[model samples]
Target: SAWLGALAYGIMKLFGPITGLFVMRFNNRAALMLGCFLCSVSTLVSSFIVSMEVLYVTYSVMYGIGASLVINCVMVLANSYFDKHLGFATGLVCSGSSIGALVLAPLSHFIIQTFGWRMAFRFFSATFVCVGFLNCCVKPIKRKRKGDYEQDKNNTIENEMSFEAKVSKRPSLFRNRAFILWVIGTAFGMFGYLVPFVHLVSYGVTNGIPVSKCTYFVMVLSGATTIGRLVSGRIVQKGYLNSLHFIQLCMIVIGVLFMILPTITSFAGLLPFIAFLGLVDGCYVVLLPMVTCSLVDYNDAILAWGMLAGTCSLSVTIGPPAAGALFDIYGNYNIAFHAAGAPVICGALILFFIPW
Candidate 1:
């Protein structure tokens, strides 16, 4: 399962940009629906895997296509739904992902223990089918009048100017200097960021921690992320300057959390870390809106967001494996924590210099 997931994730990065760019240019609604279909299909296929290699091929590779498709379209859909409350709306939308993690992580355990892993896969596939059907209900917003169309075009012009001015002033980013740096730093940062959460149970097992007790860490993290989404959204809405800077600040906290994570010896100690990580994770979602707003116009928000997510997904694609590889080499994840802090720090510094 692990290998299959990794294989899927690794290649998904390669295809993400193409899929995202194509969706932005062409029929976005169809693209969005297609993603949902892929997710549903991937889930259905997973139930039939007979070997680890098959698991990797279907769940990892095919499901990756579904995840990538969903993410690209969802960003565009989010932009359409929220104009005044972009940050809050994005936070609300992203909260579902963390909520799913919190609920499904436990539910999967129960299903696997009682029925079988295959049944668990089938259940997830069924859930995606329902979600896809719901997405089909989202009709394209029709411009009813010539005046409305003109107004929309004007809004697009204004937003484009706002973004162009920002980007024009920063030749480094346009020349691809800062963008390249940002991508590299973020990618490296991701490598170490997820290790603690993914390996928390194993770490506990190695320390003779009970399975039940160790599972609580996952719950704590998910709960923290859920709460964090709302809290960070509120904060972003209330504030005015430098959302990217705020993101950097939150990333710093995330880095510190990982750095100190190994010191936690009991559930109580772990609780704060889990919650803090979740809160910071939540802020990252809210930051997407702020970042998009900062870099592009309100009118082109959907396309800009698609590009942003496609770029950042690359970082996510690399982060976990880098952390895993570090563990393999060093026999401890301490170095990984330190490594995760670097990209965030660099990202912070880069945004600090840019005109927000």
Candidate 2:
């Protein structure tokens, strides 16, 4: 699963930029539906795969292609859908992933116990197909013409007729200081971000905690995340709370909690820390897209979100293995936790200097 995720993400780097640019120029609705169709078809194919190679091809390659398209498209759509409550809207959209994890974790075990893993894939295929078809109901928002661009959304009118002319005429995203720093800060913070969750059970076991207790810890973390996603939405609605400041605060809290992990002795003692970690971790997914939209024009959605996801994919690829290596070398999780937490804190500090 780990290697497949890495392969899928690495391949995404190639396809994501092209699809993202296409999404920016053309119809977001169509591009999004196409991605959903691809994802649904890949899921269906996964149901029939008997070999590891086939699984990798379907789940990794096809699914990555589908997801890359869908993510960029949705970032554009969500930016347009709720202009006044964009942060809340983004949070709700991202919460869908966390909600899926929350439900599917237990549901998968139940399904396997009742109908086996093979049947679980069949069920997943059916569910995804339904979701894809349902996504077609999303209404298309027409893009402003070059003539109307000046009056709409502060965008200037550009008369470039040729593809090369248009390509040469587009604004330089790399020159934007805020955008560049935000991406760098996110890339750093995202490194080792998910490793704690991946290793929590093993950490518990190493400390002589029972298996059942460790499972409960996982449940608590998931519950905390669900609540955190919702709460962040509400927090964003408050005019006094700056979105970037809130994100930085959450990161600092998460880093501090991770640093203090060694001090927890009992399940009750760990409960608060796990919940705090979830609450802080929730900010990244909920706030990132909305913040990105605020930084750039709505038309820039494809490139912005695509770059973010691609950067996030790179972070995910590098984070866990680095943490594992630290553990392997030290024969302890202290170094790993410290290493992970440091980047998060540093990222938060970097955000303090950023205007957004």
For candidate 1, which ten residues in a row score worst on lDDT?
A: 169-178
Evaluate residue 291 in candidate 1 and report its C-alpha lDDT on the 0 to 100 scale: 67
What are the RMSDs of all candidates, in order? 5.2, 3.1
Candidate 2 wrongly placed segments (more than 4 Å): 9-16, 143-167
What are the runs in model 1 whose C-alpha is more than 4 Å off?
26-28, 142-185, 298-303, 309-314
lDDT of 1 by residue, 254-347 (tens): 7777777767767666667677777788787667555654464443444444545556666776776777788789887677666766665555
- Residue 313 in candidate 1 has what lDDT? 61
TM-score against native, each model: 0.82, 0.88
| Model 2 agreement with the true structure over 172-237: per-residue lDDT tens digits | 776778887887887788885767877888788777889878887777787778777777877887
